[model samples]
Target chain A: MSMKRLESRTALVTGGSRGIGAAIVRRLWSEGAKVHFTYRAAEDQAREVIASCGGAVSASALDVTDAVACEAVVDEATEKLGGLDIVVNNAGIIRDGLFLSMEDTDWAEVIETNLGGVFRICRAACRQMLMQGGGSIVNVSSIVGELGGVGQANYAASKGALNALTRSLAAELGPKGVRVNAVAPGMVRTDMTGAVRAVAAEKILERIPLGRFAEPEEIASAVAFLASDDAKYLTGQVVTVDGGLSLLGRR
Target chain B: MQNEKSDILKTVTTVIAQALKVDEAQVQPGSSLIRDLGAESIDFLDIVFRLEKAFKIKIPKGELFPEKLLTDARFVQEGKVTAAGLEELKKRLSGADWTQFEKNPQVSSLGDLFTVGMIVEYLSGKLAATNR
Candidate 1:
């Protein structure tokens, strides 16, 4: 109908196979951005995401743990898309376990994929963004990062550290015309959360004042807003989209 | 060759003046970009970008500034660049005279090492290499 908000903009979204990452890809594409999304092991799902969007959206396999691979992905995305205007660090993994029982590998895997991955990709993207004059970075954090979860020590710590990184990068890159912000989602209904939702639906719903789990699209909307010109003045901010789940004090 | 060198000097002086927002007269060959023209750390990127556009040549990050040297312990000690550091800089920037920088190699004085004439010499060498 009317002109799209992100018309002619280019974006690179990490972990865009299924769930919240897929939703972000679709939302950014619908808003008129040329989206290049990354997937680790979901080729079929990644293709479906691109096919469904039906615009300038594309998908590539990327393992963000590899430093060289991360740099290559950013370089390829910039070259193919003409330029990089927005980077969405949505690629993250969760390893749920009690603090005592959490294996060293479990903690390292979650931290490397979630937080260290963001560091590598953001560092690469910042170089191009600096050269291009400006860009926006939106990291998908989680509410558990702030209010620690019982079985999610590793995930929570990774997301919590991501929030800190977002703030520090915002301060450093702000003068260079780049903006960095994060979105901390509450309970989003995604493929990754399907099992947990089935097991703990009623218990989880009770804590949320909104009475229902948020759709992936809702998280994507917040990410798109942060990446758009509307949030030009907003940096070093972590916008929580948890349907008031985080508002209630611990009982 | 003489006219080409003067032209390169003029272009470099104009770019530095515009980047530092200083008068062209203040950006002389002997004038230090940091001390005389008031160029700060951040202004280095702006000046480099301007030079790249004006000269249509790519300037590698560490070649002209050698920023990586600052991190190496051999080159910097106790907040000041060691004598070894000045010698390393001399090796990298062989075109320029390093008489003053050799006398005082404090980390703060590193910026003073970057003169308009140094940039002119660097560009001239780059252009000559490209032509060859």
Candidate 2:
């Protein structure tokens, strides 16, 4: 047909080199959105995604934590696509540790890159979103933000702060017609979690009522919903797509 | 714990409560300033200065307020508070009645706390102390 849900939209996804981010970029492009994404140390993966998405998608080498670099990426996207519409903040890094033994460097690095990076990109995108009268922002948080994990103190703190920011951003930008929402994902099969996949997989699977890890596509599906007209009235909400992991305690 | 010193502790507790952005009751001796209260590095710095003014006790410097003190404790490098500084605090306040203040309901801003009057008063006091 004529694309899909996001037709005529110009979108940007940070950390679109691979895994969940790559999946989002592909899905958005399929929906007819002119997509641009950034990747660091994943040049080959970035090129692969751009190749997969064809001419409608553009890939850039940039770090989300660098405010100036993040702005440049947004600027390039808007210039090439004629304007901006949707932004997906999917870039993140994990520095897992127990609170008692965790390193300050690891924690700060994760916070600065994951949480602060979201702030920088969102701040830049909001400027454009405000000027254009409206836009959608989907921040990729994590399931751990809702339920604390041992050895993930840093990750949890960063994600928890992101959830707070999502709410605050919605309040700040809603009056201007811009919507901000967050997606808290469970254990999705991604390259980033490949190391602990096996050991953590069984415990996580048991926690998930569905009894399985999610595919990146599943999380991408929820993101697409939040970024679409279907969720037009929804803002400041965090849609958890962890296959009922969040609800396991009740049942 | 209510006494003249308790009153001083109360004032100090209020300063910690304001700096950590938590209920005064939450600032117990055992309560972690970072983990339990969620204070970050910048917040700890503000708390340090506020503590100095509230208690009028100059912390031993480097030991009590090392820049490394604020790094994330979990990842050591990522967290914002330091072991050396925390240890120094423990030593300084040994046997002191650490009164937890009543948590204020309002979310106070750091920028708001550093008012023109508060800064001028603090500076004047510091100058007088040094001259003495």
Candidate 3:
């Protein structure tokens, strides 16, 4: 629907430098949200995202793994945007390796950034939300988190735990007016998935009922719906936008 | 002691009134927070948050309202407070009028002990220690 559902809303999109996070930034901004995005190291790409919005959306540097940094970034976003109405936890990382061969650092780093970062951001944002009496949190999870990919054990574990955390917090915070939800995208065309898709593009395409991978925009649309008043009644839901791939069965 | 007690009650009444969204007149010293003031589990947290800010004191989780207290075996048995439980409550809770509760100390009625008076009594002790 072509509606400005998020008009005048304040939003913080993490890792909004490229791909799905970038598309989400553009989408939320298009829907009339005053957007503040965060980028880790993609200064050039981050600038291009700002340019895409004609300098409307703002951005800052953030490493989600730093607990103190996460709180500071959230505080700044809340202050700069006037108030934090929506928080999209889209920053994540993957260390792909077979479970048996996976190094401790691989598991720890993936868990630290993907899961711990979300925990920190959500904790800080929820305080602001609780004081304001309500807000929305949309976590960007993955279909592999549910299907459990062969070489994505650490990533899957983090995402799975994230889904649980989302549900638990939704129940805890719903009474206080904050809604928490997750969007699980499958095989989106992003640099993060480029390594795996190059080797198994045909195999993955065959598994998906739609016969093609998702566009970043497709995932962004779902994030927008969850972040907006359009999905006010929806909370604690891990809505999978995977072109019916999940229905086919686990990998 | 009576004058100081009344002063604490006035402030406690205001905090509880705001937290529970009730009129100050409605929140009496004897009124039960849940039974009279329409409080639920979520409202307890709201009350705790407001109480901490109102009193300017930290209230660690489970200090004011320990959700798992009655569930413990030493304190309760078969849906009733045991003798040990009564003794524990007598020591920990100075605000409850245990004479009424002693007749039939059902665990369900444990929440009744957490009255506005109980909160005031707890805060009285807390603030006294802090001021000292």
Report the lDDT tens digits of candidate 1 across residue range A7-67.
9999999999989999999999999999999999999999899889874588789999999
Task: Score every model by TM-score.
Answer: 0.84, 0.65, 0.81
Candidate 1 has a DockQ of: 0.24
Report lDDT per candidate: 0.89, 0.74, 0.90
Which candidate ranks first by TM-score, i.e. highest? 1
Q: Residue A76 CA error for candidate 3 (Å)?
A: 3.9
Q: Which candidate is the best by DockQ?
A: 1
Q: What is each candidate's fraction of native interface contacts (fnat)?
A: 0.00, 0.00, 0.00
For B1-132, candidate 1 gives per-residue lDDT tens digits of 523789999999888877676789888998887788876665687678778878889998888878889999998999888888878888887667767766766788777778899988888888998888
lDDT of 2 by residue, A1-251 (tens): 55478888999899999999999999888877889999988999998999898756998988877889998999999898888899999999997767898888999999998899999998878867765667999999998887877888899889999999999999877866689999999888998788668677777677788888889988888888899888999999998988888898445
lDDT of 1 at B74: 93
Please state how well chain A of candidate 2 matches the true chain A, as a TM-score: 0.96
User: What level of docking quality does candidate 1 show?
Assistant: acceptable
User: In model 2, where do residues sit more than 4 Å from their true spots?
Assistant: A1-3, A249-251, B1-132
**Residue-level lDDT tens digits of model 3 in A1-251:** 57588988999999999999999999999999999999999999999999999999999999999989999999899999999999999999989999999999999999999999999999889877865668999999998788888989999999999999999999999987899999999989999999999999998888899989999999999999999888999999999999988878564
User: What are the candidates' interface root-mean-square deviations?
Assistant: 3.5, 14.2, 2.5
Residue A33 in model 2: lDDT: 84
